[model samples]
Target: MSSWQIGDITVHRIDEIPLPPETGAWLLPGATPEVVARADWLGPSFAGPGGELHLAVHSFAVEIAGERVLVDTGIGNGKTRANPAWHDLDTDYPARLAAAGFAPERVDRVLLTHLHADHVGWNTTRAADGSWRPTFPNARYLTARAEDAHWAQGELEPSRRQMLDDSVEPIRAHGLLDLVDVAEGGTELLPGLTLVPTPGHTPGQFAVVLSSGGRSAVITGDCVHHPVQLSDPALGSCVDVDPAAAVRTRTGLLERLAGTDTLLLGSHFPAPTAGVVRRHGEGYRLEPVPSA
Candidate 1:
């Protein structure tokens, strides 16, 4: 359970699922040495004989000025995704929201960092007739217009296309999609929240920045997936659309983030998610908020 307050806004993390070994391995390739050296610190980092890996899923919620905003809905319940573990349209996400002092209907906006299945899973819910519908009926679903066009071009890998259909199309079909352009560095989405373009993971991926009372926090979607990447910006995820571009973006972003006192929110970092970047040797390190 990770919660942090910035001015009048409160951010919370709501976990929905975990990735299997194979999926995890796909994300982190050199797991053996890292896992062994950081055994006590490794939450779920591991690799099997077949070179599989483990990963976790987390969704975040932001409450500002009494308005509820959800960021990156985790792999939702009963999503017909390519991955078997992501299948299943039945879960008490709504109940979980209520437990966190929120209701599904109260959500004012759903901002997707990107359109990956895991990130956009909860954008919609399974309807009575077995059709998937927008989960937050009244909230606007925000996504980068460039990303929408890139994935919709029908030239991506088959699996990527499938993810777009299930995770993005439904929101668009419901007339709730807000395809915003994120090319001018950043765009003000809400009063205190801004979308800062950090593309490369996708053609239009962006990070969410919340500024209040002279303090700021950035939700780094996939710009810096793992801590190790901070040490090797040249090392990028296999799924990166343009690895070289991603390296440049990561390097510059890390520099900008480290130069500020911004509290960093990683979409997939071990819980609490609040941290700050600091210059370490030739790379950088994340200093998370102290656990209670």
Candidate 2:
């Protein structure tokens, strides 16, 4: 139960899933050996094949004042996703939310950084009738209008579309989807939370910037996947829609936030997801948040 306070907002990570070898290779090509070794060091529970790379699935929640805002609900249970591991997610995210001191009814909003399956998986859950339904009955599911339009018009490859349907459409059906044009800068959806466009990983990806008590934190959702990417901003996930644009966005975001008092919350960062970016030789390095 990791927690951090940025300004007046309290943030929590509710991880519900993980990445597989192929996914890890897609993010860091030759790091599979290193990744496997690191997993082994963590004990047999973390061990995996040498060629397989597994990344963590991290969902975040922000509590500002009395409003509870959830950012990026990880892959949900019984989802018919393209990725085999994403299917039948066994983790009880709702129970995790309760353990984190947030009841499902308390979530005021759900901000999806992008429509990626992993990020939006918990948007809905399987109902008693065996049909999919919005997971948070009280929360308004927020997404970018541009992203929805792009995927709606474009023909997604089979695997990708499977994710889109399970992770995105259920919210649409509930009419709880709030589509915003995040390309416009500094849109304040919540009191202390603002949407900052961080496109490239997806056509309309956005980062949530929280400010309170003279402090600020940026929830970086897939804008920069790994600490190594900070050293080589040019290296992006193979799934990036626009590789060059992603590099530019990542470089600019990291440059702006590095060395400041601002806290950076990386969605997929190992543990202690909050960190500070520091200039290191040609690029940057993530200085983990100190233990309280």
Candidate 3:
């Protein structure tokens, strides 16, 4: 139960599952041992002693006033996935979410960075009749308009379509999904919570930016998937829709965040999860600021 306070906002990280060591190689092949070894800062946390990148599937829960908001839901339970690590099984994600003080029924918003199968898995859950249903019955699932549009017209892999049928389609069919138009400056979905456009990973991907009083925090969707990207923003994920665009967005985002008080909350970062971005060598690094 790790939580952080930025001004009046309290962000809670709800754990789902940890990716196997091989996840680094499969997801970000460019982050080879030689590449990760160059950035010796990732050891024992983001990466292993042997230079293996450590990643996890988790979601961030934030409650402002009485409105509870959830960022990127992790790989869901019992979903048929192509990736062996994300395949059908069960985990205590729902219980952990409830324990974090933001149960499904209590969530008001589900903000998705993109429409990736992994990020949207928990959008729905199996009901008594065994039909997929929106987990947060009362929450409005939000994502970029561009994101939904792109996937709608595009030909998807069989597994990806299955993901949408169970997780995303149910929300849309239930009138629970909201397609938000995020401008260049970002849209203030809530008083203090802003959804900023960070396209590239997906044309519609957006990072959540929470600002309150003089304090601030930014949730990196897939724009900056791992801290290793901070060491080399050029490294892109295998699934990136626009690899080159991802690198550009990542490089620019890190530059604005570097040397600031803004807390960088990684969507897939391992423990000691929250951190501040700082200038390092020719790129940047996450200066871990352990949760309060």
Superposed by TM-score, candidate 2 places the C-alpha of residue 7 at a distance from the truth, in angstroms, of 2.0
Pick by lDDT: which candidate is best? Answer: 3
Clashing pairs in 1: 21-53, 24-53, 24-54, 25-53, 77-89, 78-88, 78-89
* Model 3 stretches with alpha carbons more than 4 Å out: none
lDDT tens digits by residue: candidate 2, 81-146: 656778777887889898887788878889999988888888877788877788889989998887
> For model 3, how does the per-residue alpha-carbon lDDT over 146-232 read when each residue is reduced to its tens digit?
999998996888987998898899999999889989999989988889999998899999999998889999999889889999998
What is the number of residue pairs that collide in model 3?
Answer: 0
Please tell me which model should have the higher TM-score, number 1 or number 2.
2
Residue 26's C-alpha lDDT in candidate 3?
86
Error of 1 at 149 (Å): 0.8
Error (Å) of candidate 3 at residue 64 is 1.2
Give candidate 1's error at residue 270 in angstroms.
1.8
Model 2: colliding residue pairs: 7-212, 21-53
TM-score of each: 0.88, 0.89, 0.98
After TM-score superposition, what is the CA distance of residue 225 in candidate 2 from its true location, in Å?
Answer: 1.1
lDDT of each: 0.75, 0.78, 0.91
Error of 1 at 116 (Å): 0.8
Q: After the best TM-score superposition of candidate 2, give how far the Cα of residue 42 lies from its true spot, in angstroms.
A: 14
